[model samples]
Target: MPAFDIQTARFNMIEQQIRPWNVLDSGVLDLLASVRRDEFVPPEHKALAYADLEIPLPGGQYMLTPRVEARLLQDAAVQKTDSVLEIGTGSGFLTALLARRAARVLSLELSPELVAFAKSNLQKAGITNVDVRQGDGSQGAAAQGPFDVIVLGGSVADVPHKLLDQLKIGGRLAAIVGDDPIMRATIITRTSATDFRTSQPWDCDAPRLQNFAQVSRFTF
Candidate 1:
């Protein structure tokens, strides 16, 4: 078997998959180029790092597709002075990206193993500004409240109001919302203390976040 050209594959992933998905933000593009995604991927799936697929994680969760991850990063527009709250730290790839753009990032994960995996990945990358905690991300980190940006690493039936409340006025939260077969990638911005503006800029599907609100079933 011939060895794959990692640099060429990474370039193709950005130019062919991500760029065509409308991820045009320069900072995000640069980060995509620089971050060694293969390092974050589980060794068994490392070869699929730039293959436009959601590589599986240990807890039945998945790392978001490269395009979806890039789009979310672009939409969040995280800044160097901003503090970020990231929900669902699966592979911690997105956590690494968020750390690069924000002054600080607090990422919450539901599984202890995943938390340890993410911390190891981030630490190996020498990412010092991120704090990976094991907890229910749906609850939002209140003590670290009023963040400048929030991003959900998985899809939800609806963006939790509790998470929105953790955002400062003018802050933005990005998530893939709705059920499987179809979902909207939504960005909600807080315009005032009680007001938020939401828009579905694109469509994509991601695995449901654990412990989030689910639509109740009905029977006759």
Candidate 2:
């Protein structure tokens, strides 16, 4: 079980860390209230599950702060019938969240060990709607193409164009774009066959995914 007092603390975190940041979506807040983040965290870090900070995992990757997760979940605007794709399935925390909100969730993680861990965690959580895979996230889950929503849990200097290309008409994609000292959380929607509109939702700093990066300067 999680810390002896997670339920009350979770409500407190919402009133404190998240609501002050303007995360006002009722559906999103309900999710934060419903999901027991402690269940997904490493046993050692379960006590700090509701804190507004990242929780470390066996791998170097950390589960993103609750506010960030809640904000993104709100911006994604998931519908219960939607099919969602999530890049960087760290700790399977967000995967379970998406599974609850979407008809199905296709989550991709690069680390083989993390993939194994997530599958186990999802099973332990009794989540049946999420498909956890060990693969590259930048490639997008092509096999499950035409997703209704795509979210990159990590950040990149440039949005993955290929991933956006897979979005169905009217589908949306959310990502943190830019590197350190300047990362903006941007949402892009596929407006038409060949048009997209981008909006800056908020400023954020998330670990960059392994393969998505701006080309480094080469001084030859």
**What are the lDDT scores of the predictions, listed in order?**
0.93, 0.86
lDDT of 1 by residue, 95-155 (tens): 9999999999999999998999999999999999999999999999989889999999999
- Measured with C-alpha atoms, the lDDT of residue 201 in candidate 2 is 71
Candidate 1: residue 173 Cα off by (Å): 0.7
Q: Show pairs that collide, candidate 1.
A: none
Q: Give me the runs in candidate 1 sitting further than 4 Å from their true place.
A: 1-4, 217-220
For model 1, what is the C-alpha lDDT against the true structure? 0.93
Let me know the TM-score candidate 2 reaches against the reference structure: 0.94
Error of 1 at 81 (Å): 0.8
Candidate 2 clash pair list: none
- Give the backbone clash total of model 2: 0
Candidate 1 has what TM-score? Answer: 0.96
What are the runs in model 2 whose C-alpha is more than 4 Å off?
1-4, 217-220
Clashes within 3 Å, all models in order: 0, 0
User: Model 2, residue 196: displacement in angstroms?
Assistant: 0.5
